[model samples]
Target: MEYYISNFSNVKKEEVKIKGSKGSFIQWLVTKDHGAHYAVRRFTLEPNGVIAPHVHKYQETVIILKGSTKVCVGREVKELHENDFIFIDSGVEHAFYNGMDPLEFICIIDYVDDMSIHPVDRSCI
Candidate 1:
């Protein structure tokens, strides 16, 4: 699929769950035309919102768009502002917290078809 960069913005948006949060997110593109085998999401987080600790079989990259957030990658914790980005490797525990007002960001994850591969165990902490 040859996608003109000009026509890329024509893609539709969809809502998705941000892992452990009650909040939802909007996904702009996750197709073959986007040059990604994974999903890409653009979403906002409300004040005090949280995306709980979890790990995946595929890597994920998050780019902060607005406001501030606290990100935990394994044992490390850092405060991230706009333009900040974080890369999480597969099987590493991580989560995010919106500590300073509402936060917006883009999260990209490589798509995996097997549900057995992305085993999310909430009881593991």
Candidate 2:
């Protein structure tokens, strides 16, 4: 297999708009320029924006590179600061939000076949 470095500057940042979401919320700069085993992505959460509770097909790990955030897993909510990290198991329902300023972070996840995100509600908690 070939190896290389992917830069955030080169990847297009895409907005993550959930179907039932009300406002402009999640944005992601994603890159899959390396091995297929995983994907590296940087996310920016805008104030008033949100990532509604959802389930993933692959396990995910996110590291707080900059800014603070509020993460919700099930009915539990916790505040996270810079340098913090969180792990979410596959099929686990969760969500996160940016505080006043733009919250930035890096997320690495097992390469998914289709990156299927199933939007869920509090009832799933």
Candidate 3:
């Protein structure tokens, strides 16, 4: 068996440009290169940051690691804090907005060739 080990400090963070997203950064923790079926990523959002409503083909699981966030899943909106986790079904519209402080979270998703994100109407937010 093959394995890869990583530390957050040793990983590089990249600024990801998602439509309607502001102050968002991403760190790829585990990926296909690691021979994993799913990918693990860490995301950080600056204060008042927003990741607008969008949907993807793959299901996603998010775990809040720091600070607080306002989340919208479909028509329902809720506030989540550290240690909170949520599972989003494939094609379900969702978004994330940071609170007063920066927000951090871990996102896990299935590895797929098409992970395209489709924008959802903001009226639902």
> Candidate 1: where is the Cα deviation over 4 Å?
4-20, 33-35, 113-125
Please list all clashing residue pairs in model 1, or write none if there are none.
38-111
The candidate with the higher lDDT, 1 or 2, is 2
In model 1, how large is the Cα lDDT of residue 53?
A: 69
Question: How would you encode candidate 2's per-residue C-alpha lDDT over 1-125 as one tens digit per residue?
Answer: 46665566766667776654433333334436444567767777776557777888898898998888788875788788999999988887788766677778888888778687888855321
Ranking by lDDT: 3, 2, 1
Measured on C-alpha atoms, candidate 3 has an lDDT of: 0.89
Better of 1 and 3 by TM-score: 3
Which lDDT tens digits does candidate 1 get at residues 28-54? Answer: 656456675767767676777777666
Error of 3 at 103 (Å): 0.8
lDDT of 1 at 58: 76
What residue pairs clash in candidate 3, if any at all? Answer: none
Identify the runs in model 3 with alpha carbons over 4 angstroms from their true place.
123-125
Checking candidate 2 for backbone clashes, the offending pairs are none
The candidate that wins on lDDT is 3
Alpha carbon deviation, residue 100, candidate 3 (Å): 0.8
lDDT of 2 at 25: 32
